[model samples]
Structure formats: structure tokens, C-alpha cells
Target: MDDIAAHAALIAARRPRDARLRRVGVSRAGTPLWLLSLGRGARQALVVAGPHANEPVGGATVLRLAERVLADPRLTEGADATWNLLLCLDPDGLRRNEGWLTGPYTLGRYFRHFFRPGFREQPEWLPDGAAAAALPETRALLRLQDELKPFFQCSLHGVDVGGGFVELTRDLPGLDRRMAYAAARLGIPRELGPYDTLYWPRLGPAVYRIPPPRPRDLAAAITEAAVESTWYHPHRHGTVTAVVEAPMWGVAAVQDGSPPADRDAVLHAVSDALRHDTRVLKRLLARVRPHLGGTPDAARLLAPVDDYLLVCPGLADAWDPDTADPGRPLPALTAGHLTALGIAGRRIAVRTAGLLHQLVTGAGRDPSGALPELDGLIDAGCAAYRDDSGARWIPVARQAEYQARVVLAAFELAGRHGARARSGEPDWGTQAAVPMHRE
Candidate 1:
């Protein structure tokens, strides 16, 4: 974080008049959250990086984007949007993940060092109580939102493995295609089938309309109440929020939308893989539960594992062939679907193992003898992905470039239309009438 602060200071110094670095809020761990403001235009755009600490690609993207705009004024010369870049929203979590920041960029190192906060700890998805007592970081973002009411907002994100995709809060006609083109220009493969998002309305290839809040029950209602996503900023300020997702590693299968020859086999295999991973984690959690004391950090560490156990069964059930409707034929399962499922299973397993390893080792005692099993699990899970010959490491620079281009595309679209008030719930079926511009 000191390095990030120093870098931001240097950038601000370069353009003393136009660029200003301000401390927005302090992280839960007391690290200062800094926001770099650049340009002076009629509209405002907010670019957030490192929302999920494990996804560090956005951190690099933020730096590249700030530099790009500074180097070439023409990039945003006529675009009437002032750019506000938040380098890392969750600095505390990012610090936990610094182990692999300076890395060999291999899958083993990535998973071994990975750390993601539980849903409750995340600023964007804070529960109602948590939101009421928002983390300093969350408070800072709220203050920024109120202050800027940005016309366009983008939260940069990346997957550990998969093809590239984008999620939009408001559909800007042609923007998805343009963003896909930008990513393709950088040689990033587009995710054509289900990857992380399922059931989301696809605007175009690799482009998805983020589903609106729909709480089904008490639990869902609480979860919905906690969703303070920048995506929802559209409701308050008519902001068009776009989330750009790239991948640290690329899998060719994620780019293939063709249905697999053995659809039932693929479904069964994916479901079994997830169920197996969930069972492994559940057993490990049971072992570790007695050791974990009632502390915020302990809860935070356990949350992901607990949540996974709760959610994975339902996900697995959805894919179970016996559960499918007899009258309605199962949707054609793509090779990408099978590949994504396998990757998701490996990801959950490794992440659960990594977090549990931290808890066990940090407990200062190991009476349960779970450490050996955890170490083995971590190694095996990582090797499962790393040893795959089909997986290819994606360079950070290339990923950053792809993200930057998407940001530019959003800016261009915004500038062409300009900010306009959006009334009522957004009609998902139609393109938003508001114009978007670049910063």
C-alpha cells in the first residue's frame, strides 16, 4: 500500500494542477484508502479497482489507465467526464494477498497466496446492519458517490481463469460489441458461454446485463439489502456502471460455445466435481470450527467456507440430471460450461484450502492435525489447475491494456450520448436512453 501511495503521489506531482490525491477513508486495518482525481470535465466517471482483493489485475489496470489518460490528453480531450480512480477499494484484503503480487505468475503461487473477504466483509455487499455501520472504506465510497454522482462508473475485476467478459448495469447499445472488439484487439478471448454468471441476460457475446435485485425470502432479502453495488448507482444518479472482467489465465474451452457431445455426462461430471469439493471443505470446516475463537477476523475467514458449503449444494443440485424437468429438455451444455465448472470446483477447493491453512497456522496451535491435510489439499488443488497443459498464463500488461480499452469505449459511448435522467426501473429489454462519455 505504501508503494501504491508513493506511485499515486508521483502521478499527482506530474500534473499538480489537474491531478489531486486525497485520502477518502481508512481501511478496517487502518490503511488509508486513496482516490486519485484527474481532469476537469462536465461529467464524472469513477473507476474502482481491487474490489475483490484476490483479483489484482485491476490494480495494474488502474495504474495503466491513469498513466494512459495523462500521457495522451486526446484520449479524453473532448469527453466531458472527470476521472476519479480508486486504486484499491479493499486495501486490507489486498495486503493479505500481496504474497503473489511480485510473482512468477503461476497458478500454484496465485492460489496459494489468494485471499478474498467473506460476503459480509465486502463493502459492496454489506448486510443492512453492516451497511448501517459501514466500514470506513464503504463510507468513503458512499461519500464519493454522493459527491460525484458520476455519470458513468466502472468497477474493474478479473477472474483467475476464464475468458474475458463484461457486466453492465445499463445496456448501452453497441457498447458490448465495442468492448469485445477492444479485448480481441489485445488477444483476450471472449467468454461466449456461462462462466461466472448464469441466468444473466446476454447483451452480446461476452457481454451481460447484471440481473436486478430480486429477494425471494428472508435470507435473500437481507442479501439484497446489502447490495450497494456501483451497478445500482444508476437508480440514484443515473450512472451507467460497467464491470470489466478479464482473466489471469486463459482456457480455450471457455471460448467455445458448441454443445458437448455427451451433455448428460458433462452435467453429471460438473455437478459431482462441485459436490465433492463442497464435501471436502465441509469436513475441514468441522475440524477447524472448534479451534476458531469468536473474533471478527475468525468469522471473516470462516465466512467464505461456510457460504460455499451453503451455496454449492444448491448449485450442484441445479446441474444434477435427475433433478431436471422431464418435459423440458435440459439446456444444451457447452464445452465451455464443462470447463468452467471444473475450474470453479478447483477454484473453490483451493480458496477454501488456502483460507483454512491461514486459520490453522495462525491459530498458534494445531491439536486437530488438520494442517497436514490442508497443506496437501492446497498443493493438490493448485496442481490440478497449474498442471493443466491447456491453461495459459495471461500477462498483466495485456490484461491491463484490454481493460483500459474497454474503459475508453465506455467513455466514448458516454460522450456521444451525454448524461440524461433515467426514471423508474430500467427496462432490460431496451437500451438506456442516456449518453455515456469518456473521461
Candidate 2:
């Protein structure tokens, strides 16, 4: 079976009873793109799916939730009910990155293999204008969303090789609580914060921004939803919104070295936070459902807060702030920004090229080279692993892959010429790391 059918079968096999499943679109190869719907209530519901090609869990989670909603008929009863659920929004990216979707060989491998930074220079993620301009998968989703006018919409995505962070359309004061709960319930511990240290004037609320693309194209416009989801179809009865992002697997892995007591303490704290936060959000959402007359909240449910907490500290740093501006054209990256990203299509492709050379050619340090500072970052990140694992030497083969990529990229960025000469193409056969299964 193809990727979609395999996923669809997984959903069907494990899916709850009341959920409805159907094909929302077809692939370029004429594959049927499926969507699962749960809950029958007329109240506006959600369009939650996996947005990034690399992160399939969100779509899985949404399908799972639909099953749950279908089984629990009372979930949408009375004034609290919302709209009908919309299934996985984008299957194309999912299909494209199906290798990672197979199962976790290593989380780090999953990220580096699909290392499509959000910047213009990022060949992987940016896509050719034709594909980016709204892949058949994306356009079909927009059409469905615009026609249905759901209450709320969320896309599941992830960013590995960085810190954990959550991107929300609007600030939810208690999101920290919900996140803490997810971590605590899952037995992981990692603080979430801004991705980058810099800020922009107009996009004041964001932590970091990617640089602009040089030849601005329609794909850029599609990414920048002006008034949230409303930009897609201004005349729609209600708004259509999105939160494009990647999931951070950092939350559940904080117990490697803690005393049993300390580990429990962190878990308990996160659990307690989640419990309260979930309750608050459920209540808040319950209140909003009736107001929209069965329409999704779109952008209405989010409450802006100046002191919003992030799920990961380094979420925003990967891409420069200047590039993220939908308003500005993608920038012509200076040799500097390219130098910063190392390899895998970020800045500094040259340096990263050199590192691959060393790995492939088995070379040593070059005389006139400036190695990437990624080594220092990797060292620091190693410290983090040790701290979290209590030096238990948890099998971080997954993390090792991530470290390898970082090291490889940095070495290349330092302009190690001899190494660069011998760099071979990346091997895409490796599997992505699955999240660790903890008891």
C-alpha cells in the first residue's frame, strides 16, 4: 500500500466507532487523500491536521481524537458542542516525507534528513514556486476549510535539532499549563521559551523571524495569512486560520539523572499545571462555541498576552527574523546568514559542505579554516542530555544523529576546502527517530 493508504488503514484499525472517514482529495499519482471526521454536533469544530510533511503524529492524533469523539457521543452535547471535526489537512508533505513517518529509527535522523529550514535558501522546505504556491494538497484543504467554515483549526508540525517550542495563532494564557500537562503526563521535562533572542517591530510578539526570499512568489503569500485564516478567502462567512509549526520532542525526556523524588516532583508539577490549564481552556472554549453559531473560533479563541510562555527555548532561532516577514520579499542572503545555518540548506552551505567532506573523506582539520560554533552548541546540548539523563548514558543514538548533522554542517561552514572537495551527496535512506517509549 502507498503511504496514505497505510496511514488510513492504521487509523481505521485503531479508530473509534463514531468517527467518519473519507477521501478529501487525490494525489498527483491519483491517490485518494483521506480525511476522518468525528462528532456529529452542529456546533463549529476544528480542522486540526499535520501541516509539515515531516510530522505525521498530529494527523494521527487528530484521527485518534476523532475516534475518541465518535465513541464518546457526549463530548459535543449541550451548549458546549463545537463544529464537526476536519481530518488531516495536508497529505502531500506527509507522503513526501513518508520515510520519517515509518517509525522512529532516531529523532535526530528524522529532522536532519528532512532539514528544510523556513528560509529562502532552504531548498528542501521552500520547495519550487510551483509546488510551494499551493500544492494540490494545500489548495484542496483551503477549499474544504473555506467551504466548511469551521470554528478552530490547528496544524501539527515539528522542529528537531533545536529546543522545544509551541506556535499558537494567538496567545493562550494557560498554554504553558496544557504543555506542562502533556509533558508531565508523558513523563518528560523541558522548559519552552522563545526560539531566538531577537525581535522585530511589527511582528513584536514573535521570538524570531526568518529572512525574506529574494524572488518573492505566490508561495510566500500563501504562507503569510494576513488576518489569520481570513486571507485565504476574504468573503467567507467566517475566518480560516493556521498555526504552521513543528513539534518539539523535548518535553518528555527530563528524567535521566534526577533523583526518583526530583523526577517525580517535575512530573507532578507538570501534571498539576496541565490539569488546571486543560480545565481552564476547556471552559474557555466551551464558552466560545455557542457564540459562533456553530462556526469555528478561527482566530477568535486566542487571547493575546505580552508574557506568553513558549514550549521550547530555541524554537525561533533556526530562521532569521527578517526572512519570516510575509510582507517582505525573500531576501538575497548575504554570505553571512548562509554561513550561520551551516549545511542542509540553511546559511553557510559552503562550511557544511566541508564537514561532509571530512566525514566522507576522513580528513583532519584544515589550516585556514574557521569551524562553525555549532561545536560549542553541540557541547552545550550534550551537557543538557547528560543533565536530563543524570549521566545514565541513555542510548542517544537518536541524539547522536542530530549531533552528527550539526557537526557535519558546522565543519562544512568553516570552509574546510579539502574536505569540501570530497563531500558526497547525503544518503536519504535513513529512518527518522521515533519518540522514546517510556513506561
Highest lDDT model number: 1
lDDT of 2 by residue, 34-53 (tens): 66555455534444554544
Worst 10 residues of 1 by lDDT: 430-439
> Model 1, 256: alpha-carbon shift in Å?
0.4
**lDDT by residue for model 1 over 1-439, one digit each (tens)?**
6677788889999889878899888888888888998888767889888888888878788888889887777655567558899988998988888888888887767766778877667776535533474677777877788789887888888878877888777776678778767776877877765544554556777777776554344334322331445457444566777888888888777777776788778778778877887887788888888987743378777877676566677667766787754664344456776677777766777788888877877787777788888888878866666566267888888988998888878776654444332435444434532322211
Q: Candidates' TM-scores?
A: 0.88, 0.47
Off by over 4 Å in 1: 129-133, 216-228, 292-296, 324-332, 387-389, 419-439
* TM-score attained by model 1: 0.88
All models, RMSD in angstroms: 4.6, 21.7
Candidate 2 local lDDT, residue 249: 44
